[model samples]
Target: MQINKRHQVSPYLVFFIIYNSQVGVGILGFQRTIAAKAGYDAWIGVIIAGSFVQVFIWMMYKLLAKADGDIVDVHSKMLGNLLGSVPSFVIMIYYWLASVSVILSFIEIIQVWMFPTLPSWILCSLILGLVYYCVSGGFRVVVGVSFLSFIIPQLLFIVLYLYPLKSAHFSNLLPILNHSYKELFDAVKSSMYTIAGTETLLMFYPFIREVKSSKKFAHLGVLFTTILYTISAIISFTFYSESQLKETIWPELSLTKVIRLSY
Candidate 1:
């Protein structure tokens, strides 16, 4: 089914969409998990996991091009409607669970930091309502939100890095290849969950205005987030030692506490 031109977004917007999807609440604390086994060398695992995502993006484009529609269409083409809908339903459930996980994470952060007495269900309901409103406006509204999300926090993060940099022990990252292959691979596996949102393309492929030209933008978005995660991991590694990082739950968020700005 062809999407209306009005509902379609520009190819370049794919960068922001992909970036926003991948960089969720996970980034705040992924450092601890990735570094658990691989030690400081886990930043390398981030790059490795990103390379896998790049390849996955390439294959998705090829398949979607052939199907000429979203994942549901691909399913219908390959399998009969009845049979295909089964797996499609499962995929939809998976996305729902993923979204819920992210939402719960956001609610947890809010409750822990800003509203200690706030009930989880209230925050969850409010967030779901807001999401429903935006989604009802169609994909374009979501794309606009994605773009702003990519731009605004970026500036704040740039400033946030300065505070942590002053205390970072660069020596923490020395002996880059000291970890064994097993440890490195363990890090890669853990990092995969943090960088796993690119599969969202399967649902929105048909919503892209220039589907063919959009591949580069999609991959560029992945590359950008990959670099972002890599840099984030490296910074967290250098800022906190092996034992300290293990104890600190949200390393990135904790980095913000040290930021000081005079009026």
Candidate 2:
């Protein structure tokens, strides 16, 4: 499983990968979770949580850069062979769980919105096949597909953003900081899950061709992703009532339904 150093990705591709990976499967449910915690001011909570995640991204980069090893090697170096291997195993297990959960979530979305009669296993198999193709192509191809994914969804968002804007209620974002400090902290902690993929840098550093610029590109990727996530959250909260948002399965797609093309 030796990674070739010849296929270094540019900062922009790194940005695309971070944004695409972070945005998937979670954006649909994030509004409900944030609304539950911060009420009408959920966008504020999202912004704050995203900012904190940016910090975590930095910390992860620092840890990886300092260790100068892949994630498994870093852990083994830090915690000794036995203890480190235990935690590394747990992390890898969690990664597999997270990946499967994401794939299943996407299948569920397709079942509800696009293919009502399609079996979940069929959708899952299709997604797995695509994922296998990309993954087997190596990191460069995976990053390229990530860039394509990022572009298509963002273009869709641009179209969706232009609609009647009837659902937007700016007042829902007011009265910020009403929650207790502990409550706010808890909300932010939960929100961290949406911003978790930048930690991929740990596994990816060894594969990155430009090792010297890895931290720079990683930080840039995180910053760009955080901004996009915050903006998406703001748009979601602005357009939907707390109850409406909570009830909606995919708020962004729900928002898209309001768009009217001139045909």
Candidate 3:
């Protein structure tokens, strides 16, 4: 876990990696997925899930502090070489799965919205090439890309969502407590994947330049993600009826269809 000088990034960059890592393809369909269970109260589920994310951030920092390294080190020390290597290998596989999931989701979006005829292998190859380039340059380059990716799309997509509100039926969000506690719990679980990738922090925390001070920014990063998720849920609930939302696959993307441009 001896990070070289060139590989370390400022603590503030931690915000970008954590925030962007959690805000991927999961958000694209999360509204409908959560709404199906919690009805109009799903926004509350989003908030609850976000609260769990904040707790997770704290837990990870605590673990990293104790280990003075990443999760790999924790497992190695807590269990012993052979036993610990099992979980470490599993984590590596899990990371590969997560990467594939996000890439496929984006490729699906491209096929549906931009290039209906594009082949999946072509897209995968292109995306993996870019991934190889980013990974080869090392962590700092990846962090820079992540920061820009989160900020730029967030600005434009937030604007896209705003116009949908012009025709939104706020009454759609009424009877907010209609769901039972069990149903709300289901919704919260459903929204959890939107915050799933933050766990990767355990692998990257050792690279923060001011590792101790960076805890503050890491919490801020989680807070920022929670606020974004909460806002998106609120807008989506207000914009669509409960039944309508449940039937739609990607309501956030569908909302953009309502946007109009002036000449």
Q: Give the total clashing residue pairs for model 3.
A: 0
Candidate 2 lDDT over residue span 1-263, tens digit each? 24556766664466676676677788777767766776755556566776776777677767776777777888888999889999899889988998988988898888889999999889888888988999999888988888788778877766676562666777777777777766666667667876677667667766666566555665676677677767777788788877788788777778867776586
Whole-model lDDT per candidate = 0.94, 0.74, 0.87
List model 3 lDDT by residue over 151-201, tens digit each: 799788778778988987888878669879999999899989777888889
lDDT of 1: 0.94
Clashing pairs in 2: none
Give the winner by TM-score: 1 or 2. Answer: 1
Off by over 4 Å in 1: none
Per-model TM-score, in order, reads 0.98, 0.90, 0.97
> How would you encode candidate 1's per-residue C-alpha lDDT over 143-182 as one tens digit per residue?
9999999999899889978789999899999988999999
Each model's total of backbone clashes: 0, 0, 0
By lDDT rank, best first, the candidates go 1, 3, 2
Residue 80, candidate 3: Cα error in Å is 1.6
- The numbered model that scores best in TM-score is 1
Error of 3 at 196 (Å): 1.1
